[model samples]
Target: MPAVDWRVTRLSRRRSTVTRAQVETVTGRALGLFGLVFGAQTVPIALVQADALLPGAGAALMAVLYGAIVGLAVATVTKVAVRTACLAFALLYALALVAWPFLVDDPAALHGAAPWLYYLCTVATTAAVVAVLPVWAAAYTIVVPAVYGVIRLLPSGGDAGPLLAVLDALYAVVLGVVVLVIVTMLRQTAGAVDAAQEAALERYDVAARLHANEIERVKVDALVHDSVLTTLLSAAAASTPEQQQLAARMARDAVQRLDEAGATGPRALDRVGLPVLVRRLRAALTTFTTPFTVRVVNAGGVELPVEAVEALYAAAVQAMVNSLQHADEPGLSTRRELRIRGVRAGGCVIEIADNGRGFAMDRVPAERLGLRVSIEERMANAGGMAHIESRIGHGTTVTVAWPQGAGGAA
Candidate 1:
């Protein structure tokens, strides 16, 4: 057999418990009241008919006591407890139904009203059996009446024919079948509902996984365009010995980044600190071909993951290169500034601004991946963001920040 799903099992059990409780609550109250009235009515009748203390009279009284005790006990206990009491009472009542015929000294009493006291208790016991032990209910229903019919046909029993005995027995048996069908239908409906809920939850989990994978794919595409390809192009364009050496160093860094992306080991980014990161970036900037001013403010002791620091450093370098290659004008002096500041909220921001002629943001071609992939998407992939502010005559400012809320330094 296949292993059972614990979720479905739990749901079925919970629903069964609620259904069992409802059955017990309704049956307990109804049966308890019925037993009290039946006992009151029959005790007096038995006393009058027997005219003196007798076994038959005593059995009638015991039936009443059994019914009242079981009924009241079912009302007070939990569903499982009620079920146990119901089964036990059903067995005891069945035995009493069989023995009541033998206990009676008067044969006429069996045919007349005295037998009804036993019949009433038997019917009530059958109902309790139906509520708790649904599978065995039909058997008990048939057996209770069959045993009574057999005794009525015996020599000691009242002069009753076979046909009359069977007809009386069939009435309660039919009622038991109807109760069984209704309970079975309800259980099937509950199972269907639990199955539907489990399927819906599984679908939601699958959809969420697919959406996350799509997002990660977009980030990887942007990183490849921004870092690896850009470094290779710079190496191809180098003319002087110093420029070639710088390009080779950048190429090595780019390859190492790619290797780290594919590695399964623990990430280097998890151990990077802001102070050490800033010192390395400052050293790299000293080799830039174009002269620029660098300033650090409140950046000491701040730290971040390697991914965030790498994004900021790479984007800042691209911004500086853009200024050196594209911002210079023929007849005007230009000033470039790279500022790194640690915010009070516990993350660092790098602003690369140039006081040189700038281009319109909206007019930039889609093929120019320098700004889109290198600066904007790189920061986005690192769980941070980049903003570019520029105008035709004013200047361009590329601001990259890792917000405190985006898993920055603790």
Candidate 2:
């Protein structure tokens, strides 16, 4: 097994998190379907008023405008062309609104009814907001409705009085603003969530490194006392040639041990590869008194801090020891599992589960330090967390993860 490096580095990877882009994709799909359905509803209304439009080219123009909107909606939902489709829909709708007067066969054809284009102002605005920047979406939301309001007052338009046109414009603007605000809020919230998740992982990484330093200090101290001091005493007392030769060999071994623990190790922020951690863990598992069914799924290329690795390994061993001491039944055969798997951001999850007589977590006494202090507290100090799940006669599972919150890797 490769030696455990005492030096730990700052975490640079993130656990699985809810990102802004993920929320935006969902928002786009939803708005795309919204545009598609509402845009298609206006089609029957357009067909009914088709005669009022210019002959021959009127229906073709209607199809072109509606086709683009609906097709873009489909593309948006499929995620093949979201922003591009929304941009096309917004631009096409605005141009269509400008050409509405010319498309009419007669200026007075629709004596009182509002034009079909008036109903689609919000849909176009929705597309703009979903695809473009806030400034441009706001511009479209204001300009498109204002243009529609103008068309509503023209002879070629319904020629409705100013009151109704203003009311219609205000309603569209309000609706567009509401949609834009919702999209913006969702995006901001998702971004904050992503940030929080990253910050938490970083904190865990730092804590784990500190704990690793402490553990290493104690081990190095023990090595110096047991090996180096013993060798020095033997050298001082040696008189015979054979005894001196043994003392020289002992001193050499002590030097080699000190070298391994000295300042020549990895830097404080260097990554310990997952493969090395896995190798160490497997070696530790083989030392256990009780055999466990083990499964390993390596997360390729993940490198975590030395402290995180040490913390996870220590927690797993504690959990196994806990199971050996407690999980048992007189007449029942017990089975246990040890699963170590790679998680997001190069961290790992270690699960120790047993199908034996189990005890409730809440009932585990505060005085018992096996689960509370040695296992759970140790992991917490090391920037990881230990989770205990159990019920009487069902089983117990102690799940621990580095970078925090990566319990789902199992």
Candidate 3:
């Protein structure tokens, strides 16, 4: 490829990549906001209950410490830094709960016989952290929760104390399992949301590009019609033979320019399904032209590239629009026939053929510019071909062969 072409392709690819990345970044930010909401609720509850959970410290002090840690962990979610911070805090929590019972001579009475709640709390806290933590934090969460629950069940007081502790420890283990299940469900939901958002953004980008392309083509069409065609017409009216010949040449160039304009835009391609799109076009065609029969032979489940689909739809719509606009009769308008089919031999191929009031393909007059932009140019760029079989008074057969996998999905 030439340097200019290569450069253009590279730039286009880079822009697409950047757009997808922006979508992902937006999703990440939304997830972060959600985490903050959860943290705001959970942290306060943990702090208020800390005095009961950790008897040695003042409730305010414990709450503040735990709140600070939770806040720090939330902040680090933008990076993976929060995982280590959370794990370290969990370890500290384990040490404090373990040492609490041994701090006083009458530790059993101070802890109210059963300290199983402390172990369970630790396990739940660790499980919550694991949801937001890095992938590697799994080991610490699984092991620590299991170990603490088991250790907390050991004999401490008489039969009553021991039995209560064992039940509490069992409850904590169950709590940890519940947290793990919730976390997994939330992760799957988040992933599905991300995928849907990505797909939506991709569709939007394709639509914007197609619109911009159409505007550019229209501008080119207007320029040729307003300035160049007018000049050519004026020149052709001059008496001089040389002026007439030159004017004729200029007129031909203008016709070519008009045709070139259509080459700018891609075909219309609807990604969800082609039949759904075709049905819409058929309905729109009904509004303008009657006695127009649309025969869709086959449109199997064939996925096409975005660009190819866009091209196919554009060509088909243009053909139908032309039939509605130009092919009317004085009293009895001609009957138009449209045939659309899809094939997936190598890749998808959508062929749309319309038989309506046709024009003479051989003698395209100096004024006829619609075919230039709508038929010939657009199909060429889409890596497709357009064939028009038309005769005056009879109908025109416009066949558009769309090559799939060339254009991006529209």
Ordered from best to worst TM-score, the candidate numbers read 2, 1, 3
Clashing pairs in 2: 8-268, 9-269, 208-382
lDDT, residue 364, candidate 1: 92
Off by over 4 Å in 1: 1-77, 109-111, 121-135, 154-158, 205-410
Global lDDT of each model? 0.63, 0.78, 0.53
Residue-level lDDT of model 2, residues 1-410, one tens digit each, is: 32333322223332344456567678778777777777678888787667788786568867877788777768766666677788898898898889888888765557678888877777888889888998899999999999999988887788889999999989999999998898888888886875565455446556655656777788888998999999999999999999999999999999999987774432244455565555556667778777887666665566777667777777788888889888988887889998877876577888899999999788878899888888788777766788889999899999988877774633
TM-score, candidate number 3: 0.39
Candidate 3 residue-wise lDDT, 216-276, digit = tens: 7778768777859786676958789888877777777777776666554444333333443
Candidate 2 Cα outliers beyond 4 Å, as residue runs: 1-19, 59-63, 78-81, 107-111, 228-410
Candidate 2 minimal-lDDT segment of 10 residues: 1-10
Best model per TM-score: 2
Backbone clashes, each candidate? 1, 3, 15
Candidate 2 CA-lDDT value: 0.78
Off by over 4 Å in 3: 1-88, 98-105, 116-142, 153-163, 233-410
lDDT for residue 205 in candidate 3, whole number 0-100: 44
